[model samples]
Target chain A: MPNRARFIVQIILLFLITLHARPPAAHEAPPSVRAELPLLTAPAISREGYFTLQLQSLPTVPLVVEYSTDPQFTQVTAQYPWFADFSQMTLSGFPNGQHYFRLAQAGVDGSAPNQVGPVVMVRVQHYPLNLAIGLLCFGGAMFGLLVVMIVRGHWSRSRYE
Target chain B: MSEPISYALPTSLGVALIIAFGILWIFYGWYLGRKNQTHDDFALAGRQVGLALAMATAMATWVTSNTTLVAPQLAYQLGIWGMVGYSFAALGLILFAPLAARIKQLMPMGYTSGDFIRLRFGRAAWWPFIVISLIYALGWLVSLGMAGGILLQALTGLDYHIGMSVILFICVGYTLFGGLRAVIATDFIQTVVIIIGVVVTAWFLIDKVSLASIHQNLSDNHPKLLDLLFPAALMFLFNNIFFGLGEIFHSNVWWSRAQAFRKGIAFKAFLIGGLLWLPIPIVTGFIALAAPQLGIYPPSADMIGPMVTAQVLGKVGAVIVLVVVFSALASSLDSLLAATSDLITRDIYCQFFNPEANDQQLIRWNRLCLIGLGVFTWLLCLPQVATLAALLHFTGAFVASTIFPIVLGLYHPKLSGRTATLAMIAGSTLGLISYFVVGFYVAALTSSVVSMLVCVLGLRWSTTSFRWQQLQESDGC
Candidate 1:
C-alpha cells in the first residue's frame, strides 16, 4: 500500500482506539478475573499477604498477574503478562491481623475479557522487588565498567604518545 | 474598572517579550560561543559542559511547567504517592547514564535513535518506528507549548493564543540560532532559578505549617488519599518507568546529548543531572501543605505547583514561579530543536536528498532546519490540550516499547534487522492499540507482551537453528 493510504488507516485506528478505550479498571481489567481459568488454591486469611489466581487471556491467553492482600484490601493491580513485581504488593488501609484479598485474570487486550477467580487470600506486608532491582543494578554496573574501560584506553593512548 | 488581575503579562505583551528574549538569548549565545563547526561543538558545548551546568539544564528542562503547574492534582487527589510517583521520573536520567556509553560506541556517527532503528531494522519496519518516535516528540513539544500559554494566562492574565505564540517564538529564537550550545547555556541559569523558586516556596511552607501538622491535616481532612498502596498508586511506579524509559531510549533529544558530550561527559551529565533532578518534585510537592485548610483546588494539575507557590509565598512567589517555569520551558525546547534538527539533517537530508553533502553544507542546513522546525513546533503548540497525561501517554507507550529494540539490538546479534524492525512495529502497534484502541495501561501492557513475544519467537527460531556459518558472515564479531 502507498504510504498515504497507510497514514489514513493509522489515523482512523487512533480515533477508534480512543473511542473504545474504557477508563482502565483498578487491575489490568475491571469486571474481575475469570472463575473457570485458574483455581485460587490458598486459604482466604493468613498473616502475610499472599494470594494465587488463575485465568486465561489471548481470547484464551493463560499468563496472568496475581496479588493478595490483608482484609480491607487497600490496593490491587495487575499488568498484562503478569510479571513478578506487579503481583507483589503490601496491604495498606485495612485494619491489622487477618485480611482476605481476591484474585482474577484478564487479557491485556480486550479480547477474552478477564473473569474473577475464586479468592484464595493470604495476609502480608511488603513484597520485595528484589529481582527487578537486582537486574537494574547489575545492568547499570556492567555498562559503567565498559564505559570506564573505553575512556581509560583513550587516556592511556594519549599518555603513551 | 480593574478586572481580577493575573500577574501574567497580556498575551500580546508576553508574545513580544518571548520573541525578544529568544532573539536576545540567541545573540548572546552566538557572541559568547561562535559557530560550532564540528558535530561536537554544535551538539554539545565541545563536550566540556561541567556537572553543575549539565545538571541544571537537565533538571530545568525535564520538569517542564506541566510538571510544576499540573502535577499537584496527583498530589491533591492521590496524596503522597502522586508527587512521589512524579518525582520517580528522575530515575530515567540517572539510570540512562550507563546506556549512553553503549549507544555512543554502537553508533558513533548517529544523530538520532531513528538512525539506529533504521539501521538495525530493515526497510519493512523502519517507517512505523519513525512515525511513532516523531509523533511522541511532536506531542511532547506541543504539550509544553500548551502549558506555556495556560501558565501565562493564569499568572499574567494574557490571552491564551498570544501567550502560547509568545512562548513558542522565544523558544524558537534561541534554539534555532544557538543550536544545542545556546540551549545548554540557558539551562545552567534556568536550573538555578528553578531551584531557588521551588526551594524557597517549600521552606516557607514548612515554616508556616509543621510536617507533623501537615500529616495530621492529611489524616484528618483527606484520609483515603493518604492510603499508601492505593491501587492507582501501586500501578504508578511501573507506568512511570515505562513512560520515562521510552523517552530516554527512543527520543533523539537524549541521544543528541549522549553524542554531544565529550567522550566521558555522557555518564556524568546524565548521572548528576538525574540526582539533582530527583529532589525537585518532592520539594514542589511538599509546598501543597501550606494550603491544607484552604481547600485550594488548582485550575488543573498543571496549575497546582504554581498556585501552591503563589498561595504560600504570595505575589513575589508568583514571579519566581513564572521564572522557574520559563527556565524549564527553555531547556526542553532548545534540546528538542537541536535534536530534531539533527534527525532531519542526518537521517532524512543526507540519506534521501543529498547523500554527498559536505560537512559545511550539512551544518548550514542543520541551522536552517533548526529554524524551520522551531517555527513548525511553535505553530503546533498554540492549541489547547485537555489531559496532559493522555497526550503524554499516547506518545510514551509507543516509545517505551523501544527498550527492547535498543537494549537487545546492541548485544544480541541474533536480534537481526528483520527481528528488530518487527519488534518495533509489533511493540509500537500494540502500544498504540492499548492506549488508543484498548484504552488503558493494562491493555497497553498486553500489546507490548504480544509484540515482545513476536520478537522473542523470531529470536528463538533463528537461535535454535544455530546456523554457525551464517553467524560468521552476519555477526559484528
Candidate 2:
C-alpha cells in the first residue's frame, strides 16, 4: 500500500512537470505583442474563383479591410468595417485578373489610423487546357487498366477451372 | 500545440457514448466467443465467414482514419485532385480480389501471411518480410491512435491522452473477448453507422451551400483547385496508387481476412467492398471544397473536415462527425490488433519460441499479445508528433518494397528466396534515400520500381521450382 502511494505521487509529479513544460498556446499573447504589428495574408496567385483572406492578429483587436484592382488607393472596390471575431472572408466573382488588398487597424480612439498593412496582390487566371488534358489521359489510362486486369483475371480463372 | 479547440458536444455525452458502446461491443463479442473450440476458430473464425459479413468487414476496415481526416485534408490542400487521388486507393482492394482467390486455393490450411512467406521463401526471405510487416502494422496502429485523440479533442474538450486511452481500451476490450468473430460482427454495424453519418452530413452541407455556388466561388477565387494540370496533385495521383497497393498487398490484415472468408467468397467480397468504398472519398472530399465557401481556415489541415462540419451543421453536425470518426477509428484499430497479434502468436510464438505449443496455449498467448500491444500503442500516441498524412506515408518505402516480392513469391517459381531477400533490402534502402531526397509522394513509386527491377532480374537469373503442395504443410505447432 505504501509503494502504491509512492507510485501515484510520482505519476502526478510527472504529469505536472510535462504540463508546465509545454509551450504557451498559439492564441496566447507574448510579451512582444505590442512591438510587432498584425498582418494580412493572401495567396500570391489565386485561381479565378472564390478565395479566402486571413488576418493575423490578436483575437481581441478589430481590423478593417480594403480591396481594389488599381495599384493606387484612388479606387476602393470593397470595404469591411471593424470586426473582431470574424478574421476570414470569402470573396467571389473575381474576374480573371490581378487584384490588390490592404488592411488598417480600426481606430479604437477617434483619430488618425495607427498602422496600415502593406499591399498584397492576388492573380486570378483561367484553368490551363493542357493540364486538364493530361489529367484526363492519366485518369482514362488508369480506368482502362482496371478494366483489363479484371477481365484477364476472370478469363484466366475460367480457363483453369 | 494550439489551444485545444472545443466543439459543441458536452464532455459528459462523449464519455457516456464511449462507455455505453464499449460495453455493448464487449457483450456482443463475448456472445460470439461461445462457438470457438479450436485455434483456427479463434484465429480465422473457423474460415466460414459469409459474403455479407465479409464484405462489410472489408469495407469498414479499409475506411480508416486516412479516409475520414486525410481525404478532406488532401482536398483542402491539393484541391480537386486530392480527393480523386485518394479514391484511387480503392483499386488496391479491387485488384486484390483475384489475388485473394489465388491465396485461398494455394494455401487452404494457411494460418497467416507469414506462414506463406515462410513456406515459399525459406528463412532467408521470411526474416526481412516479417520486419517490414511489423513496421507497417505499427505505423498504421499509431496513426489510428493519434487520429482518435485528435478527433475527440476537436469535438469535445476532452484531454488528448484521456481520449486516446479510452478509445484504445474500448477497442482492445472487445477485440480480446471475441477475436476475429467479434471484430467482423461489430464491423458490420459500424459500416452502417459510418455510411449513414457521412451521407447525412454531406446532404445537409449541400443543401445549405448549393453545388453551383461552390463551383462559381472556386472558379472565381481558387482556379488552381479546378485546374486540370495541377503539378503536385498529378504527381500525388500516381504515387498514391503504389501506397495503397503496397498496404493491401503485403499486410497480414487483408491476408487473414482472405483466409477467413468462406469458399468462393473472398474475391466477390473484395470486389464489392472496393466498389462501395470508391465513392465515399469523393463525397467526403467534396466537403473540404466547401471550406472556402464556409469561411473556415483551420490551424491544421487535418482538422478541416470536423471543423467544417461543426461550424456549418452546428452541434448536431459535430456529433455526427464525432460518431463517424469514432466508428472508423475503432473498426481499423480492432482489425490491426487482431491481425498483428495473430502474426506474433502464430509465427513468432509457435513457429519459433515454442514448437510444441498447443491450440489452447496459442489462444492464451494471443490475448496476452493484444494487451501488450494496446499498452505500447497508447504510450506512443500520448505524444502527438506528426500529422496523420505525414505519419502514414513515412512508412511507404518500407511497405512498397515488399509488393513485388509478395506477388512474385506467390505465383512465380523462378525467383529464389535469397534473391527475394536481397531485392527487399536493396529496394527499401533506395526507396528511403529517395523519400528523403526527392519527396514523400515518390517514396512508394520509387520503391516499387526498384523492387520490380530486382525481382525481374532475379527471375531471369535463378531457377527454383516451388511446389504448390508445400504451402499446405502444417508448421504452426
Candidate 3:
C-alpha cells in the first residue's frame, strides 16, 4: 500500500511539470504562408530621437521586431515582441544615432523566424542643448518684464483713480 | 499569446449615455433661456453672474479637452516636464485675474475682446486682431470637436465621425437654446463631475500600479522620458506658457466671461479658478507613465490616458473616463460656440453691416452665427487634419502674436494702433516661418518675443497717448 501511494504521487507530479512546460497552443499551429511580406516604413529623420514604424499587411501570427545599428544586423541590439498586434509601433529613447528595424513572424518550436520584412532606417538628430537653454532664458526674461509692466501699470492706474 | 483587450464600454451603452446627457443639457438650456428677453441677457448673461458661478465657469472653461487629453499625450511624449509645463497654463488664468478686473472697469458693457481691440486700437489694429481671433477660435473649436470623437472612440470603440458629429450637435443644441446662461450653469455642474472623476481615476491608477514601479519601468525602457535635460521638452516649457497667455488674453471666450460676471467677482473668481486648476494636468498626466508597465501601447499617443485608465479599472473606469472627457469637451465647446458667435455678430456682422441693428435682430443673428460656426467647425474636423496638440500649437503662432499688443494696448498709453498692427503682422509672419523652419515648440515663444520688441519700439517712437474713455463704447443694441 505504501509503494502504490508513492507511485501515484510521482505520476501526478510529472503530469503537472509537463503541463507547465508545454508551449502555448497558439504557437504550435503551422505558420501561414503569405504572397507578400508586410511593408515596413519609418520616418527618414527624427529630431526628437523617437519615431513610429508602420507595418502594413500584418499577418495574423505574432510578430517580433529586431533593431540594430548596422544595416546587416550583425550584432542585434534587441528583439522586441510586438504586443497586441498593433500596426504602428512607436520606439523612443534612441541616443541620436541611426537605427535599423525590421519585422518577422516570431519563430515557433525553437525554429527560425519566417518571412522577414525589409529593413528600414531612422536617423535621429536632437536639437542642440545650448539653443534650447537659450530660448528658455529668453522666455524667462520676457515673462519677468511682462509681470513688471502689468504691476506698475496697475499701480499707476489705481493711484490716479 | 494573449489577444489585445478590447474597448471597455459597449458602443450602445456609450451612445445611450451621450444621448441622455444631451437631453438633460438641452432641456436645461431651454429652461434657463426663457429669461433671456434681450440680446444682453443672451450674450452676456445679464452681467449678473454671482461669485460661485463665476468661479465655476472660469475653472471649467479653462479645463478644456486639451487639459484632459493632450496633457497626457504630452507627458507620454515629453515626460515629466510635459505635465508640469501644461500646468503652467493656469498662469494664463491667474495673470488674467487682474486683467479681468481691469476689463470690467474699462468696458463694463463690452461684448467681445474684438470690441476692445477695435475700440482701443482702431480699424488698422482691429483687422489683424480679428483675423487672428477667428483663426484661433476656429482651431480651438475643431480641436474640441475632434477630442469628443477621439475620447469616445478610445473608450467605447465608437466611430470617430459619428462621435464627433453627435457631440457638436449636442453642444450647439444647448448653446443655441440657453446661450451663455446655460453654458455657465452647466459648466458649474461639469466642473464637479470633472474634479471627482479625475481624482477617482488617478487614485485607482496609483493604487493598482505603484509609482515606484512606473518610475523603474520608464527608467529602464524609456530613459529619455525621465531625463531632466530633455531638449525639446525644455524648449516647450516657456513656449507653452506664452501659448496659454496668448490663448486667454486674446480669445473672446474669456473676454465674454469677464464681461458676464457680476461686479467685483472677475478678479477673485479668476484667481480662485486658476488655483483650483493648477494641479489637474499633473494628476491626469502621470497616469500615462504607467502604460508601459501595463503593456498598454496605444495605437496613437492621444489615446494613452483613457486606454490606461480603462485597462486598469475595466468597465467602470471606462464609464468614468467617458463622462469626465465628455463634460470637459462640452464645457469648453459650448463656451467657444457662444463666445465666437458673439464676436461675429457684434464685431463683424453688426459692426460692419448694420450698426443700427436692434436687440431682437442682434439676438437672431447671434443664434444664426452659432449654427454657422458649428457647421464650419464640423467641416474642418471632418478631415481629422492633424493630432489635437499639433493642430492647437499651429494656431499658437497666430494668437501669441497678439499677446504683447493686447497687453500694452490695454495699459500703455503710448502704444499706437499702427504699431500694434505692424507688431501683429511681423510677429505672425516670423512665428509661421519659425514653425516650419524650426518646430512648433518655438512658435509661440518666437511670436511673443517679436511682438514685444515691436511694442517696445513703438513705445519709444510714439508721441501719442490712448484715451482710456474710448473703450466705453455705447451698446448700439
The 0-to-1 C-alpha lDDT of every candidate, in the order given, reads 0.58, 0.77, 0.85
- The CAPRI quality class of candidate 2 comes to incorrect
TM-score of each: 0.69, 0.82, 0.91
TM-score of chain A of each: 0.28, 0.49, 0.65
Ranking by DockQ: 3, 2, 1
Q: How much of the real interface does each model capture, measured as fnat?
A: 0.00, 0.03, 0.25
Output the number of the lDDT-best candidate.
3
TM-score of chain A of 1: 0.28
Is 1 or 2 the stronger prediction by lDDT? 2
State the lDDT of candidate 1 residue by residue for A1-161, as single tens digits. Answer: 99967964674454334322221121122223333544334444422121223222322223333333434434553221321111122222222234343444444444433565544554433223453344334434533543453345445534653
Worst 10 residues of 1 chain A by lDDT: A83-92
In candidate 3, the residue pairs with backbone N, CA or C atoms under 3 Å apart (3 or more residues apart, or in different chains) clash, namely none
> Taking the tens digit of each residue's C-alpha lDDT, what string does model 2 give over B1-477?
111123556655665666567668877888998887877888899999999999999999999998998898788766788889999999889888888888998888788888888888887788988998999988899999988877766656566677787788879988998899889989999999999999999899988988998787677555667764666567667668878888998888999999999989999999999999998888878898887666555545676788788878988898889889889989999999999999999889998899999889999999999999999998888887877887887788888888778777766667788888888888788878977886666677778777877888988988777887889888759
Where is model 2 more than 4 Å wrong at Cα?
A1-158, B1-6
Which DockQ value does candidate 3 get?
0.12
Query: Considering summed lDDT, which 10 consecutive residues are worst modelled in model 2 chain B?
Result: B1-10
Candidate 3 Cα deviation (angstroms), residue B462 = 0.9
Candidate with better DockQ, 1 vs 2 = 2
